[model samples]
Target: MSTTTLPDVRVARDEQIAGALALALAASLAVQNAVVIWVGAPSYADPMTEVLAFHADHRSAVAIAVGLEALNLPLLLGLLVCMVGLVERRGGAGAAWSRLAVAAGAVLSAVFALYAVLWIGVVLAADGLTEPTPLLELVWQMHAGAFALVMPALGTTFVAVALATHAGGLTAPWQRWLGLAGGGLLVVAGTACLPIADGSSLLFVGMPGYAAWLVWLIATGVRLVRSAS
Candidate 1:
């Protein structure tokens, strides 16, 4: 008698499906964040307006920042999902370093991303409880922007590592490009938000890159959905 074990096709299929899901989530979050910028930035587009606004009530100013920063949660989640999907592929592939790299970075960065969101919540709740001051204003905005910086930094690293580990050709080229371009644009766009008072205008600068990545993600999701059948 002879016996053989069947390969774990279920796990393999799930991993592929997850990669596509993560891509779609990231793209949707990016677009949603851009929408908020479009809705809110016009009110404080002028540098002088921003300065004046910040003086009014650190609460309100931080309010705007908080709302915008909210987007980071989903973006980071998507990044983690994408990283996991990519890392999962290496489970028994002998690329221990690559798998570990993405996982460790995902955990480290997700912490900051979550902290960034919670900080805004703290500031928001503190609005009536504490007095608003320039120092506090700077504290929130500076930190908000700071977290934004680190997020994309680590996010991009994850993308690079994932792309390095991913084994596919032009047929699935969008996934790799989305990972690279999405993460890159996020870093650039987040940095650009620092220079301009109106994150909206600056966000448009990233629209092309964002759109490219977004479409890539949606397409990936569609592919996965179809594959499931």
Candidate 2:
């Protein structure tokens, strides 16, 4: 009996940790988006000069967003580790999906890291430049492309984790469906990543998907926390 109870306690603890990490990740991303919106960030269709000016004028805000992203990557990885462990321990059927989630989450983290670094470079380079140089445009484009590519990686993680957890009976049918829909949209948007990087309107397709993901994160986090309680 003691042995059985010990394992239960550990599972509960892991769930709590995962829930907290999920909430934190969502909050961090929300704050970053708020900062970007508050700064009136230029759209992709905007001139490169306007983009350069925005970065130069709002260096501090951009830096803060980058800092939050740095924090978010580790939180994401932690949540993935916890979720994968929980799924594997609870249901063997989900093992394959959990593995896929891990792979995709790893890619997502690496891509996000690159995105943050590129933003940092942009901020640093914008320090005193009055106009956008060819080099600046190149770095900015790379940064944009990196961000666009992140959508597909994120989509894969979302779908895999949702399916894995559902197989483990850790998520409801609604949650599973939501994840699938959102993930699918993101994947579709990723197919046009080059255009998205160029500031095409196709990028809008992923915006709702990303918002759905945030909602899913918060809802799932709540469910996990309540289950632990």
Candidate 3:
């Protein structure tokens, strides 16, 4: 293509990337919420029977949640790529923090996505076996462990994002502060998870903090898309 068209093509690609990232972020949030809210997935402390029953009763929802989470993996990667692209375009010292955020986010994405797959197995296999309690407990423990382990990564990603945005003044002051606070809470939740294998009540901090972060993600995505426009 001619030089004139090259820039236009580049702009279109950038917009598409930004839009996809935004949609992905929104989708990830929506899927998780639907699983918990609509499917009535039990709390971490619930007995194995309850967990099994919940999954059995809501097998379809569980399956869909798993699929959505699997889909989220690519979306997460796309968001990270678009974020890096946006940061690099800004041409600031904060690019380092953005890069770190992207790295941590990638890890966070994998951890969550893997856990979702495990849960899918739990849901599918829960009803078939004659004695599934032990298996359910084991899987639940593994899920809890994965959740705990990934918390630090999510925290780091948020904190790095906060730093990058703060340095670049790319977001509102409150939004940056939300990231900092959410990151700290996630780290604390991880630490709390160590002694409390049943899933610390504090680990529930992830729920609200993550919810708030979802809003931030939505806002960020919108900003990115608008800028591309």
Best by TM-score: 2
Candidate 2 residues 202-221, lDDT tens each? 88888888998899889889
What is the C-alpha lDDT profile of model 3 across 2-75, one tens digit per residue? Answer: 56577566755675686657667686768777767876788777777777778777887877777777777777
Please count the clashing residue pairs in each candidate, in the order shown: 0, 0, 0
lDDT of 1 by residue, 1-229 (tens): 6443234465446545655654655654565456545545323233433433433445454455455445545554554454445455545342453455456456645555564565565454344433545554454455445544554555455455446445422126556666666667765865764753222365445456555555654565565545544
- Roughly what TM-score does model 1 have, to 2 decimal places? 0.55
lDDT accuracy of residue 24 in candidate 1: 51
Runs with alpha carbons beyond 4 Å of true place in candidate 2 = 1-4
Compared with the true structure, model 2 gives a TM-score of 0.96
| Model 1 bad stretches (over 4 Å) | 1-8, 16-20, 27-35, 41-108, 111-115, 118-132, 147-151, 154-158, 161-171, 181-212
- State the lDDT at 98 in candidate 1: 47
> Cα deviation of 39 in candidate 3 (Å)?
2.0
Q: Candidates' TM-scores?
A: 0.55, 0.96, 0.86
lDDT of each: 0.50, 0.89, 0.73
